[model samples]
Target: MKEFIYCWKDLEPISHIPSYVSLTFIACVLTCVGFLYYATNTLSGEKNNAPVITTTFVAIWLFIITILSLQGFFLDFDFRPPKLFIFLGILMLIIIGLFAFPRTRAIIAQMPITTLTYLHIVRVPVEIVLWWLFIHGAVAESMTFQGVNYDILSGISAPFAGLFLVGMKSKSKLAAIIWNVLTLGLLVNIVSRAIQATPYFHNPLMDAQPNIAVFYFPYVLLPLFVVPVVFFCHIASFYQLIFIKEEEE
Candidate 1:
């Protein structure tokens, strides 16, 4: 493990951010990563050993992001396009590649729709963390339910949508499809709001608060890992409901 020396700039924010919020966000991060591993392992099966490789790769990617964040690499707001945008773009391309490649698409398709549906429950904690961040001045109200973001609804309804599939015995994929589409729209809404709130593209009309908290360590994981995973879950859910045939439960 490489040693990271923390400077005063990196250490100052720790005193302001509440412990509970940090712990809760950390838990959500673990859950999201663990859930993805479970879903990947379930679909890949023991024969392929894909889970080990995929999870290892994800872990390494996250470690690099975490290190950079702790070093304040993303805190520079003067850079055009922003470091956050660059990393997020990379993540978007990776997601697209997962769905575009035949072999990877096949593996992703095998993920149980029910599992994908419930995986969103992690978002509930995410919203809470955002709300807390707002209270502490780390993020803007526009990113929380009190403002423009309505993503909490998606997290709250995830279980019901998953249960709807179970209750209907997979007889209808329409309910899940509608839910996924609506929730995906919600995801896009907040993500757009977040992007606009970035320091480089701060929109005064949107809210007085700027979304800079994510440029810090731990919180940086929100964009680097949590949001992307949730986005992928919604996309995966859509792919399963629409393109793949649903077998009776």
Candidate 2:
């Protein structure tokens, strides 16, 4: 377990942004615009199955990546690199079931089981591993926090992901509103904190800023990408739950 820390630390890819207004920045910006477009439509209460799943998966990945981005949170223990074997194993089982029996996919596809947020349960272990990595210095500082501390936002993948799952599963418009509001609230709050901490983001350039590492906005607002998708998921999930409720009624 102790030796794993070294491996994890090295594997925490440090690919630099190279130029602030570089290709990576352009890509991230485009991605953000795309997210806003799709999420805006979804928030308007459009029901689309493919978009919902795609958004949910993107939320999961973004949340996971953010967690992975943090560095040196853990200093006292030996951290190990996490392998997603368990997830893969479970995923394989789910896949086999889907192929073996049509009902399996049907049952799995059922949405909004309840307020318990089961739709994102598959991601629980990933968050756990990330937490352990943070606790042991396996991961490093984020473009968001610059220097991370043990706090609500440090191990954000879980609760934030939970928020996404919750909003997606809810049937109330109030929930969707709350989800979007929180998404922006949390995003702005964290970005402000990161900017305050990191000199690079002292004066952020909106779309016209020079090509810089923190210029892409992910370093400032790590949740920007995930939040919209998650917020949209909330709308889709709510729509789903309402439909399910009416069917039961």
User: In order, how many clashes per candidate?
Assistant: 0, 13
Instruction: List where candidate 1 sits over 4 angstroms from the true fold.
Output: 1-14, 44-46, 166-171, 247-249
In candidate 1, position 47 carries an lDDT of 86
* Top-TM-score candidate index: 1
Model 1 over residues 1-249: C-alpha lDDT tens digits? 011112323445446888899999999998987888888778644586667877897899889999998887886655667788899889988988898889888888887767777888888989999999998877889999989899999989988887765334543577777887899999999988888886656666877767778888788888888888888988887787788865522
Report lDDT per candidate. Answer: 0.80, 0.36
Error of 2 at 230 (Å): 2.7
C-alpha root-mean-square deviation, candidate 2: 16.2
- Highest lDDT: which candidate? 1
Per-residue C-alpha lDDT of model 2 across residues 71-183, encoded as one tens digit per residue: 33322233332222232234335334443565433332353323223222222332233233233332223322333322234234334445553444534445544543554
Tell me the TM-score of model 1: 0.90
Candidate 1, pairs of clashing residues: none
Q: What range of 10 consecutive residues in model 1 has the weakest lDDT sum?
A: 1-10
Q: Which residue ranges in model 2 land beyond 4 Å of their true spot?
A: 1-180, 191-201, 204-228, 235-249
